[model samples]
Target: MSKQSEDLLPLWTLSTTETELPLSLTEPMTPSRLTELRAVLAALAESPIATLEAHPLSAPADTSKGISLGRMSPLAQELATLAAQSTRSVPKAAGNSGEVLYRMVVPAKVAAEVSGGVLEPMISKAVPGGVRSALVGTNGISAHASFVPATAGAAGGSAATVGVAAAGAGALTVAAPLVLLAVAAGASAHADHKRQLEIEKITALLEKLHEDRLDDERNRLDGCRSAIDKATAILLDKGKIGLSLGLDTAVHTIDTALASAQRRITDWRAALEKLPPDKVELRQLNDAIAGIESPGSEFYVHLELAELAIALKRRVIVLQAVEHAQQDDGNPFESFTNSINLDAQNLEKIVTGLRDVLLRLSTLQLDRSHGMRDFTFSSGAVDKLLNTSHRLRALGDRVEAGRSQSDVAIEMVQKVDGSIVVLPAMAAE
Candidate 1:
C-alpha cells in the first residue's frame, strides 16, 4: 500500500470481547405476595378450574390519567413499565374471567436470587396493604394485580348509598321518607356509575401501558439491528484493506471471521421474533445488540484517534518550521510574535479537539458482563485510552500555564512535537 493508503488505516488498534449479560428478573415482593402470585400463576397454567378474584379497581390518587413510566416514582414507574412490557392475553373462558398476565422483566441480578419460593426482602417495613406478586410460568412471568388505596371511603360509600336507598324505599308511605328515598336512589346510582367509570379508566391505562412497552422494545431492536449492519460494513472495509496489502492469509482469516460475525447478526435478528415483550426476551435482545455495539463503538473511537494523530503530526511539522524560522538569522522575538500567536491559537484548538475525544470515550458504555455487574475492557485498548487522556491533560495544563505570548508560542511548538511522538507510538501499538 502507498504511504497515503497506509495512513488511512487506524493508527490505534481496537479490541473487544463477546459479552452477554443476563437480564434481571428480581422484583421486590413480600414472601406472602410471592406465594399468592405463584399460586395464581400455577392455577391459571395448570388447573382447569382455577379462578382469579376480580379485585375492585382502585386508582392511586397520585396516578395520572395517562401512564408515563419514569415520570412518577422510579420504582412504581419501573413496575408499570414492566407490567406494560409483560402484558399478554391468556385463554378466554365463556363464564370465567380468563387470566390476563403481564410478564415481569427484572434484571438478571434480581432473577438469580428469586427462586424456590424464596423472595429477597429489601424493604425494611412492609407497605400497609401494599401486597404485590408476580406469577412465573414456563412461557414467562407476569405481575399481579396491584391496588392502591382510594380516597378514604370511596369503596364503603357506594355500598352505604345502596343500603340507604333500600331503607328509605321501605318507609315511603310517609312524605319525608318518600323524599329521602328519591335522594338515596339518585346517590346510589351515581356511586355505581362512578365506580364503573373508574374501572374503565384503569382498563384503558393498562392497555396503554402494554402498547407503550411493546413499541419501545420494537424501536430498541430496530436500533440494534441498524448498528450491526453499520459494524458489518466497517469490518468488511478492514478486510478489503488486508487484501490490498497482499496479506492473502490474513485476508482469508478476516473473511472467515467476518462471515461468522455476520451470521451471528442474522441469528440475532431472527431471535427478535415478534414474541410477547417479556423481560427475559427484551433483555436477551438488548444484550445481543450490545454485542455488536461494544466492538463497533470501540472501532469508531480508534478511527477518530487515528485521524487526530495525523492532524497532530502535520501540526507538529508546521511548528518545527516556525521554530526553525525563529532560531535562524537572528530573528527578533517581537518579529515572530504574530506567528507565535497564530500557532498558540491553533494548539489550543487541538487541545479542544482532544478534550472532546476524551469526553466521548468517557461516556462510552463498554461491554459489561452480567447486566453491568462487572465492567470489562481490552488491556491494550485501556492502556492507550488512559495514556492518551494523561498526555492531553498534561498538554492542556502546559498550554494554560503559558503567561506571555512568547511562552504560549514556544510551549505550543514543544507540545505538538512531543504529541507527534506519543500519538504515533500509541497507534503503532
Candidate 2:
C-alpha cells in the first residue's frame, strides 16, 4: 500500500448544550417521610392483583436531584420539578429498568391553569362546608416522593451534559392503581383539609434563562449596530478603495451592518419566547424598546446583507474559539504541520456546523409563525393554538449542520505580490 500524507484538517464542532435543569436542592422528604414513602411503595407492591393504583407522575424523591413529591399532586403544578421533563418522543432503550423520567416544563401562567384545574384543586377550599371536590379527588390517590440529582456542573466536566449513568429513570410501569390511584380511590374527611397550604412551586429556573438569552441576543444586536455605525463613519472619511469588482464597497458595508441588526432582533425574540415569564426582566426595558421597531425589509437585497453580516460574525467567533482551543491540552495540533493555522482542524467542524444554523435561518426566513415543519394546527384560533402548542419536537440530526471556522468566505482581494486577502478576521458563517 502507498504511504499516506500525515496532514489532514480536523473539524471544529460545538457540543450540544444542556436544555434541562433540576427542580430543587433541598430534600423535602424527611427521614420519617422516606420511611412513610417506602411503606407506601411496599403497599402498592402488595396491592391486590385486580386493584388499580397510580403514582403521581412527578419525579421520585432524592437529595441530589432536588425533585420531590412534597404532597403536591402532578396536576397541581406540571413543572414543580424541571420544566424540561416533558415526555420524550424517543422510546427508552430496550430492557432498561428503573424510574422512567418524565419532564413537564409548562409556562408559568399555563402551569397555573394546570395546578388550579388539575393538581391541587381539591386540597384547598374557600369554604369548609364542601365535600364534592374532596369526593372527586378521593376516587383516586397518589403518593409522590422527591429526590434531587447531584449538581449538574460537579457531575459533568467542561461540557454541560449530566452524566448519563447518574440520571435515573422515570416512573415505573405498575400493574395497579398505584399511589395516585389510591389517593383517588378513597380519602379521609380530614384529607380535604390535610396540609391544605399546598402550593406547587416550580423548581425550573426558566425565567432566568430566558431573560439572560434575551439580553444576550439584544446585546449582540446592539454590538452589530455599533459596529456598522463605526465602520460606516470610518469609510465615509477614508472613502472606498476602488476594487472595481462591480460591487460598491461602501454600499455593501452599510448593507452588512444593517443585516446584523435585524438578525440580532430575530434571535432576541426567539430567546425571549423560550424563557419563562417570571425570569424575564422588568417592563422598564420593554417600555424603552416599545414602538422602537427594528428595520424590516422583504427585499432579497436586505436578506443578502443580513447573510453577509452573519457570515462576518461567524468568522470572528470561529477565530476566537480557535484562540481558546489553542490553549486546550486536548488539541491534536501536535500531529499537524506548523505552516497551517493551529485551529485549521477545527475549521472544518465549524463549517459543517453552519449547515444546521443555515437551515434554522432558512426556516426563520420561510415561516415567521412556524419554523421548519411547525405548522398551525388549531381550528379557528390560529394564533393562540399555534403559539400554545408544545415545542417538544427534537430537531433531527440531518436538519442540523455547522460550518468550518474559516468558511465564511469573502471576495478574495488580490495583492500585487499575489497573496489573496481574507478580510474580516472574525466573521459569522
Candidate 3:
C-alpha cells in the first residue's frame, strides 16, 4: 500500500494544553494567599490577553496572515461539541505534587509566547506579596510559573556577572539560523534517500507479481491434467459412449478457457510494455496489472459444464432408444436424445443453474487494478489505496470457479438401468 501524506497541523487552529506551575513564597504561605494565587493563575491561563506564552511543538502563528486559532469555524465548533461529549480526562495527582498543575485552553498565539521573563511580573502582581525570584514553567500555552522567594541581598558584582552571561546567550542565539539551515539540508537528503528505497521496493514487487502469475498459470495447467486423468479413469470404468464424449468435450473446453486466459494475460503485458519505465507512475503500473481479468479461473467451470452436458446427452439417448424399442418405433434413437433429458425436470434445473453461473461469470467485473498494489515514493499512499480498494471490492468469492457438474451428471447416469446399455444401432458395427 502507498504511504499517506502527513497532515500538518493548521497554524491558525486554536489549541489548548494543561500547565504545571510551581509557587515559592517570600514568606511562609498563608491559605488566603494561595487562594489568590490560584484565582490569578486560572484567569491568566484562560484569558486570551497578552499573558506569556510558550509552545513546545510549533513556531508562533503569523498574525500577519489574519489567521486566529482562537476563533472556531462553524463546522469546527460543531465537531468540537461532538468530541467534547466523548472526551475523557485522566485523573490528576491527588496529593500536593509540589507543583500546581492547572488545565488551560488558550489560543495558539498565547501558547507560543516564551515563558520566563513575562511570567515573573504577572506572578508578583497576582500574589499578595511580590515575588522576589521565580522559575516559571508553562504548558507552553499558559504560564505554570513557580514563584521563589528572594534570597538575602547579593553582592553588587553578581549583577554584572549575570549580565555578561546573558550577553553570551544572545551571541549563541544569533548563530541559531546558520545551524538550523545545515540541519534542514541534512533532513532533505535523508528524505530523498528514503523515497528512492521505496521506489526500489515497488520495482521488486512488480517483478514478484509477474512471477506469481506465471506460477498460477502453471498450477492451472496441473489442474487441467488432473481433470484429464479423471476422465480417463471414467472411460475405463464405465466404458460408455457418454464417458468418451464427455471426456472429449471437457478437453476442448479446457483448451478454450486456457487460450482465452492467455490472451488476456498477453494483452495485460502488452499494455505494460508500451509504458516507458521512466514515465510510468508506480500506481499506474500496478493498476494496469490488476485491471487484467483473466478467465483462467473459469477453466474448470467450462470444463465441468461441457462434460456434464455430454454425459446427460448420452443417458437421454439410451433412454429414448429403450422407449423406441418398446414402442417399435423406426426412428433413430439419436434423433430423440438431447444434451439434457426432455422427460425429467432435473435437466431444466441443471440448465438453469448453468445459466445462472454463466450469468455471474459474464457480470464478473473485477477492479483488480488496485492503485495501492505496491509502495511508492509516498509510503502511505499505497496503504490508503489498499484500504479503499478493500472496502469497495469486499463481496463475493474472488476466485471465479464453478462446482463439479460432472459429479451430478455421473450420479444421474448411474441411476439408469444397466441392462439397457445395449449398443445403439450406430455403434453396432
Judged by whole-model lDDT over C-alpha atoms, candidate 3 comes out at: 0.26
RMSD to the hidden true structure, all candidates = 35.1, 27.8, 37.1
Candidate 1 segments whose C-alpha is farther than 4 A from its true place: 1-337, 344-347, 363-429
Candidate 1: lDDT of 355? Answer: 43
Looking at candidate 2, the ten consecutive residues that score lowest on lDDT are 7-16
- Writing each residue's lDDT as its tens digit, candidate 2 over 1-429 gives 112122111100111122222111123232233234333433333221111111121222222211122223221222112112212211120002222222211122211211111122122321221111111232232222222221212212321111122233212212111111111111111111111211000112222233354334333333443343333222222233233432234334534554454554454345444534332222221232332111121222223233334333332322223223234333312111121234333333433443333343223211123336546544544443233221101212223233222111111111222222111111111
- lDDT (tens digit, per residue) of candidate 3 on 199-274: 3443344344554554443334334433343432232222223544444554454455434444544454465556
Better of 1 and 3 by lDDT: 3
- Model 2: lDDT to the true structure: 0.24
Question: Each prediction's Cα lDDT score?
Answer: 0.25, 0.24, 0.26
Instruction: Give the Cα-based TM-score of candidate 1 against the true structure.
Output: 0.17
